[model samples]
Target: MRLVVAITGASGAIYGVRILQMLSALGVESHLVTSRHAMLTLTTETDWTPEGLRSLATHVHPVGDVGSVIASGSFQHDGMIIAPCSVKTLSGVANCYADNLVTRAADVTLKEGRRLVLVFRETPLHLGHLRLLTQAAEMGATVFPPVPAFYHEPKVIDDLVDQTAGRVLDQFGLDAAVARWEGMRPLRERQDQQPDHQAALGEPVNG
Candidate 1:
């Protein structure tokens, strides 16, 4: 599967890295783009350089290189994910203002009726942010903020990123490598565990 993974100037750079690592492990082709501010934020927050990130992608292109293949809907990508999508980028996408290749690719993804996942990484959001998100959603984009549920009992920051990435990957039929939450306790009994019990032809036990 061809996946376009973009990193913007958001604090959760690790989410973008985790997405790249998982996509590589799953043998999905990753086309990467990082905005200038994104590189600055990455180096300030993480160990990888812009070149280091380029090494992870099958094809890495400049943010301004609108001539890149992905700028066109015919390039045939399964999806596009802006992990750690910055509010700036989100606004651009929301308005269909393809000032650069990142926004153009996202526009292409939406126009083609393919999946576009924006891992919006802003907090203390204002009403403007909500309005932008609503606009993006109305345009058939999935606005996935970097929020994880506590019910999953995430142990580390990576755990939270993985769970969210996994959920995002589900839309593309890619495994996020995070364990699924079956919403029940594990079944075990003296070395013989029963299959997960879903209600059958009886009065359901709400266990």
Candidate 2:
């Protein structure tokens, strides 16, 4: 399978990084593009250098290269994912602003009737943010928020990152085997074993 992965200037660069890693492991071809500001976030949020990030993708495109093959609807990709999608990029896609390769690729994906997943990273959203997200969704794009799942019993940061990345891959019909809810037993077990603690933490114990 082939996919386009874009990283923006959002706070969580790791989501983009993890998505690339998951795609690589699944033997999926990834066309990577990163906004210029994404470099700053990458350095601030991860130890990986720009070179290292490019190494994860099957092909790397310059963010300014709107003429690249992936920018066209005929490029034939399974979908496009904008992990850690910033509001700027979201607005661009929502408003049909294709000034860059990332947004252009996304626009192409939508026009081609292929999946376009946006892993929006902002929080405490205002009304404008909600409207942009709604607009993107109405345009046949999936706006995925990378919210952590405590039910997975994540012990480290990687666990949380991997779970979210895995779920994003799920949109492409790729399975990364990241922790997922198998049944109610796990939650029931936790509830039965730690009712007081669950109540104290304001966690639901029963359905």
Q: Report the lDDT tens digits of candidate 2 across residue range 1-207.
A: 999999999999999999999889989999999998999999998899999999999999999999999989888889999998999999999999999999999999999999999999998999999999999999999999999998777889999999999999999899998999866666676766653866677888563
What is candidate 1's CA lDDT for residue 82? 96
Global lDDT for candidate 2?
Answer: 0.93
Clashing pairs in 1: none
Candidate 2 vs. truth: CA RMSD? Answer: 4.0
Model 2 spans with C-alpha error above 4 angstroms: 186-188, 191-207
Candidate 2, residue 77: Cα displacement in angstroms equals 0.5
- Give the number of colliding residue pairs in candidate 1: 0
TM-score of 1: 0.86
Candidate 1, residues 13-120, lDDT tens digits: the string is: 878888888888888999999877998888899888877877888889899999999999879889899989999999999999999998999999999999999999
State the number of backbone clashes in model 2: 0
lDDT of each: 0.87, 0.93
